[model samples]
Target: MTKTFKTLDDFLGTHFIYTYDNGWEYEWYAKNDHTVDYRIHGGMVAGRWVKDQEANIVMLTEGIYKVAWTEPTGTDVALDFLPNENKVNGTIFFPKWVQDHPEITVTFQNDHIDLMEASREKYATYPKLVVPEFAHITYTGDAGQNNEDVIAEAPYKGLPDDIRNGQYFDQNYHRINK
Candidate 1:
């Protein structure tokens, strides 16, 4: 038998870590730990599931998703997942005052996600900034996995100083507990 997720309920109680590959490297904690009445808009469903105080809206389409929020910070993100593959191509557009947005690609499987920036020229001026041109992160505490055990056995260590000191490479973010 094959498994299919046709509704938000399928993802409820799931937790995952989201990482960005831009020079100002950052990671987001995502948890589908809430239940809400999702508003259906045409071919998309919009609602909030992540445990954040900001007003957020998530739109889901076939193989694509868009999540936008306003509060502590404002951001507009769109992700297009590849067919049958744990890979996605996306872009992040920040409001003015943040920085120029860049195209990003991501791949995920089980409890891990890897992100890479597709455009480097966008930050030509801030050359010394260490952005995770590539970032790898893990999502623990899912599917009966122990968060502590996962963190202890995680492959990547702390961010290298070279990466912060101007050297650029794929960076790794340790698994964070929810």
Candidate 2:
């Protein structure tokens, strides 16, 4: 079963955290031919719109925006299936026909701030991939917080200094391999 969101406030109100060794990115699709791109940005919903790169699409239905942190914020966020142009405005951009059929699901993970389920439909023709239930996250948090910090902060800031010289995504990136 999937969770349904009636408003944007309900979406952003949900809380989950992302665990990434190198802070990866993802692409999402809905019943319509709409797509969204996201990147792991620390302390904020990290990612971009798949259709247009310049457009900084933040939230889906509500302010249920995506956020990444080195440590868990102890806040809960929601997830939902929405049909809107990936933009900063955070408004619904769908035709009258789409209102009848929505394919987004809202899920909460023990350690994740957010996760997405690509639409799996017959006519809309979207790709379906199994979103992992357990995710490994790396972020900088209070060392005294939990036992998980060992693994999270290690790889998160493990990239070696030499490899980090040219260009990188986040300040925590530490190239472990030479």
Candidate 3:
């Protein structure tokens, strides 16, 4: 069946399998394993414990775009990576379909991922790629196929309960807003 994801949350929840970003977990342990400067494995952004990377502390997943090594310290490093010289040349990725369809654009930023589908909002087919770090989730099967099933199969089955209550993806697996 063709998928219809209205938001990024819906997309990630249904299509992408996500974990705690093991690299970040190692980093968190390295920084706080046995020291006074101990912090949790996940970093806090906007009061949420989002995943991180080696030099970055945020990993956001949208429909077709995924980003790692994002800095969360209010620094301009992320800005430096953005396109300043050319609007048409600043994007990090241009899937083969997007390249042929110039009007469609999906921009992945530190906080959110935005997809502008030109005039084909409902019909655009998003990329079906999964980040290696988070590939345990499965979106298939019959009656038992729910969020719980996906989470249980995840590498880290014990994610904080609060994380599930807020603006999480839906069964359809897409997020519409931040």
lDDT of each: 0.27, 0.25, 0.24
Cα shift from native, residue 124, model 2 (Å): 2.5
lDDT score at residue 18, model 3, on the 0-100 scale: 21
Per-residue alpha-carbon lDDT of candidate 1 for residues 31-116, written as tens digits (9 for 90 to 100): 33321111111111111122232323243744333333432223345433222233334454443322443212111211221211
Greater lDDT among 1 and 2 belongs to 1
Find the candidate with the highest TM-score and give its number.
Answer: 1
- How high a TM-score does candidate 3 get? 0.20
Model 2 regions lying over 4 Å from their true place:
1-38, 41-127, 140-178
By lDDT, the better pick of 1 and 3 is: 1
lDDT of 1 at 136: 30
* Candidate 2 similarity to native, TM-score: 0.18
Ranking by TM-score: 1, 3, 2
Better of 2 and 3 by TM-score: 3
